[model samples]
Target: MNHNEYMMKKLYEEIIERVGVGIHAVNQEGKTIIYNKKMREMEAMDKEDVLHKDVRDVFRFQENQSSTLLKSLQNGEEIVNVKQTYFNNRGVEITTVNNTFPLTMDGEISAAVEIATDVTRMERLMRQNLRQTKTDFTFNHIIGKSSEIKEVIALAKRATRTNSNVLIIGETGTGKELFAQSIHAESDRSDSPFITQNCAALPDTLIEGILFGTTKGAFTGAIDSPGLFEQAQGGTILLDELNSLNISLQAKLLRVLQERKVRRIGGSKEIPIDVRVIATVNEDPIDAISNNRLRKDLYYRLAVVTLFIPPLRERYEDIPVLIKEFIQKYNELFKLNVKSVSNVVLQFFEAQSWPGNVRELEHVIEASMNLVNYEQVIEFDHLPYQYRKSEVKMAASSPEFTESMEETMGLTDQLALFEKQTIEHYLHKHHSHITNTAIALGISRQSLQYRMKRLDIRVQKI
Candidate 1:
């Protein structure tokens, strides 16, 4: 061959060797002639085995009757840009988008060039993006923004990126489920199901069946069923209050986590499962383990990463924000144009210890919005009588408590009580400086002044 022709052949060979697309040349007899480096790599095959192999023997799929590429090849027509799924030698699934065109020589088909692009990674990413787009997630989906809540969110974000187990601990109404959802939403497996089950909510036998699945007729009325773990395959299953589960159940769960497989109850077959576990508990699992409520080994397995959420009292600054959000939500829900809570009501909200945390605050707002008049500011009267009585009792029970001063009282009695107490406390504490008081309280000076009037807390200096 001439040097120019040799150089041209060398250039084409290099392109086939280095190009990202898997290239294969098949003669008119449908036997592979040229299998490039990429094709070999994608199929996990060596050059020798692929060079003389039949294309059909190396690739299999359900027959497509109207397949353009196959039809074109048979009719000596050119085909291009056809996508198909092909199996490799070891039966691993590979997705390839390709173009197949008949090679023409002397006005006759001599061979065909099949250019296949492996799109498995691209397809997986697209699926992930699509799932994220469809996910219904928002800040309100979580309950609080306290420093503790923020820390939990940060930890959850980090944990989701990895395949580690996570344990979230908090009291009831403290949004343990919210942490679970946030982790799932931030994970690579976010596209998968984020299933949850309260261990305390199920019986031991049923819980076992629900988690590890069951075969048809395993027991009376126990038909074929996939458990929470199976349903959460390629995703996460949040076992809330995992410490509450029985020790026997913990053993099964530990096995699932360690072996990455689960046997259906009353069934001999062990099914493989791939799922991320993010469990939550109100009690410390370590404490549970110490008390024998949870197995020590299982606790260690689940506690690969531990996160804690502080009670609302620790994050009191978030109370006002949470109250505002709750009010707005209930306002729309109850069809009330409730403007805002009076300073008297707000002070009562902030001062009282919330045993139920954000949940208690939400209920208070929801109850007030339903009972308040349209476009009217909610005052102590709009608040539940129990809450108002409790606040009064708490205020009276304090050292500087004033009592029996307003018998047969009206709005003026409440105004006088607030102005004399709440405002007096801040003014005295900050030397009558609104800016200093607001700063100490972590609120805007304007908001502090607003509270002054709403509570009828007068600036004796102003």
Candidate 2:
């Protein structure tokens, strides 16, 4: 090869390796021939494991479709922005969008190349939002040590003793549903079904039909259906955000609660339901009534057995326990060794009134942990962009971070530090098995060996 051509080839290869997207290419026979670093990271596979292997064998799906690369190679079709799911050899589910193009040589298709963008985390999060609660998750999932929370739990535990309806009032994200599930799990109806419906999630027309069964001719394209109440007949139904219901629906719900009977939308028969009721409201009951968001009479009936959950601000003592729990949780989840939060972060967290309560704090920590690669402590820089405002405000008051920590190394030195720590962590995890560590780190074994040598990580001797 000439000097110019060789230089150009090297530059192109470097660009492919450094690109921020996954790239994989397959030969005409559908064997993976080229897999870049990003591709290895995305699929959690080494090039050695993928190269020369048939694409069909590396990934599978129940839809019985060929891999995108194979499809492109066989049909000479250019597939763009197609979102699909694949089960890798390890049975890990992956979701991604891909652009695939068939490469031709001498007017014949010779290979196919795919550019992939991983969306597995996003799609799973969306699914978790939409999926129904199973209720096997019991009181153990509730994390708190404060007497306020303990008293609430005690009251909820008492509520489970009887079949009386329950009203849980709390700020949003204060673990109302956890209490509901805990009650259901401990109730006499534990063997029966437990169902939940968000009353505020639907409109008047749809929610009425959903909560109260609909006849075939009840509305346009309506079919005979049993409502959520009937579905929970032998168990419990949790109506979330009860105050968000329209006044008319509130009256209807009140009637159902009072009468213990439900009449279908268009039917004359009143069906007797033997379901236990548990409902939640995300506001103070008195204000909800004054604002016309809730009916006083209905509130009186639902609050027959009331349990109030204190918000995070009201229970500041639980912050340290929660932080430790979350750190341990995410350490197991993300496969890392995050030991704790820095003192400043902990102080800032305790000082702030978490408007979103425990859920918000958990998310902040989760996002911060995602940024923590090799750090033992989650520093202020690891806080998400949304929380940076709070840091700026805090700096004005105390100037903690600016004075306490200063950059001690250049970019190259810092990069080396991170690499050394990361390699050492993975080495410990994999018992210094070079191939396993390399696969876990998304690098070829030889590359990992070279990096270890340069970083002075001596555990490869094991």
Candidate 3:
């Protein structure tokens, strides 16, 4: 070869190696000819492992039916932007978006080239960014006027004044995350990154790496990476359902909290991090402790500024305001002009126990709005099937009854039966909790116990 030809070949090889994407090419005979540097990095393979080998032999194509390069070479076709996920021979999973096409010369198939973009990091970063954006919530966005809710909001607002870790306790669908975000937004570190993770969403090994980071060579295919704690430095990290984390991992988290430092998995150095942590638990902390789902030390560390949000049933006075706000929200979202809910519908909403709390109420309103047919008012029929069934049950259990019941009983007898049914309904709704059932019934615990004894009500624990 001439000197210029040698330099030109060198330049082509350099350009292929320097390109951002991973490039692999196979000759017309389907033998691997080019495996560039980026391709080696993405696949965690060396050039010696792939170069000059048959493409089918290198990838073990007999094991995978979706080899785009082989298909492109065999069919002389092009495939673009196809996402593929596969496990390598080492059992490490790799995900990539690929473009494969036949290299044509003089109207004849000469070779096939495959370009792959590793999207694993990009996808993880995108999810982290999405979690960060959820910190847009603030105190102003919290929708409630009842005294109990106001009290919780007041406590949460006080919590934002300091950098102490916080623990928010509430039942499912009670907007615990909303309170957490509001606290973060109101805090001194409001301008910094706010990251969130659901502890239950991932297995322990993955969740640990995601929370504490991982060092390169921590395990096979583990890259040196910053976890959520590092990503949330100088800001806040909200760990939802913190009790869902295993005890061993909880111990590690507690160490991080106490020391304000995190050590990456399989690394020796401890890195300092300055972040406010806010954790949430759907169940009662006592229950979590008793069930061994949460560590007592971790609980104490996290509950430095504990905030307990009342359930919707306990804050019944907020129902009308919440309904109005939800209606306005759905009106804007659905592009409808629903002005109000019928009085009967409002009564049904107030009387029914909202086990799913505020979230359920929002969903019910959204469903009703969808079924309203441009009507200004949401009627009984517009409610969800569950709510409709509730309305029927309420009507059937009311003091006024059907002709069949009247034919069998007198007024006094009917009144006694209705009273018994009401007590039983409240008991079942409150999960047979005597105190809560009494509170809902507008009676003292002693009075409720007396009624239960007199009425032969057998309270069974749920």
Candidate 4:
């Protein structure tokens, strides 16, 4: 080799060695002829291992990039900003954002040079930022992903954005609170106060004072405290079981709804408010008006954007997911190692009509987690008895309810009974279509089969 040739080769090697980007030169046959130090580090490979190796043998592209990457390599076209992350043996994932530009010699593609820039930290930060920016109300926390639930969420989100009044109607235990909270969370008011008041929990006078502020001298010992509507200023006020509010109070609420202002007790001046209103009623507002529990005018104002949350029995498909969340919740709270439910027990839960809905199921799982002594998997015996009280012969079931064995029986028996009753109820609800039945039951087809064996429940094949 001449002196100039030697110096030229040394300069080329220096450039490849010092560059931070992973640079690789592959021959026309797709064999690695030159692999830089950075390239070997990115691949977690030794210099000897990658040198003279087939490019296809060691370098793996993403599943969807086969055609574009291979064709570009053959045709000498440049592909840029191809994003990918590769995991190494040490469990470290390296993200590469790069361009693959082919080298042509004498007007024909001969070799290709890939310039890969390490972007692991950047990619991780981007993902973290995306997660942080995610709306506080998530599809996951909302429970059901059914089409009905999806439509409701989308409409609720739109309503929240516009500051419209929302009236949520659902049977008791149908997760009215969840929907109310989600709407508030997804709205611009998420960072503001989310005040909740159950109208039925107070007497008419007390309820009026709670919803609207009272003057210090209005009544004996009145301290001029602001009520829920004032407290929720610049945010949202959730009126739970709004139908329970009496006729007179409804008139006051309707005035506020129309005027967007409130007058303190014994005070002539009206104080303006920017509070958004969200009310939930277990009964239909129309029925409430007919029965004189709710005023027709107030109902129309509150129902500007109405949402109905279906009963637990109606959306039985969500039972299993809710149960699992409750199980994980209790496991964390009680510091238990319980992992899952047995097929029979799961089937029992899936099939039952959860009249009490998510709240009822959560209570049952929490009780069962505290009851089970040895098994990691919750069996039929781990459930409560209200579930199966009708089925158990009274005398024979007494020994199972002994107080000495309360830890052994009370919680578990209740859960089991609840699970059994729920399964039987849903089976009847679905008219016993095993597929729809299994879906409502929230278990695998196989698990349902085993449960049928244990419960001695029969259903004619659809």
Per-model TM-score on C-alpha atoms: 0.58, 0.59, 0.68, 0.56
- Note the clash tally of each candidate: 0, 0, 0, 20
Off by over 4 Å in 4: 1-139, 391-462
Q: When superposed on Cα atoms, how far off is each prediction in RMSD? A: 21.8, 21.5, 12.5, 23.0
Clashing pairs in 2: none
Off by over 4 Å in 3: 1-126, 129-134, 393-400, 404-462
Residue 455 of model 1, lDDT score: 56
Q: State the weakest 10-residue window (summed lDDT) of model 4.
A: 126-135
For model 1 the TM-score comes to 0.58
Which residue pairs in candidate 1 collide?
none
lDDT against the true structure, each candidate:
0.72, 0.81, 0.83, 0.72
**lDDT of each residue in 30-87, candidate 4, tens digit only:** 7777788887777777777767777556555555654233456787689766666655
Candidates sorted by TM-score, best first: 3, 2, 1, 4
Most accurate candidate by lDDT: 3
Candidate 3: lDDT over CA atoms?
0.83
* Candidate 1 stretches greater than 4 Å from native: 1-140, 143-145, 395-462
Tell me the RMSD of model 2 versus the true structure: 21.5
Clashing pairs in 3: none
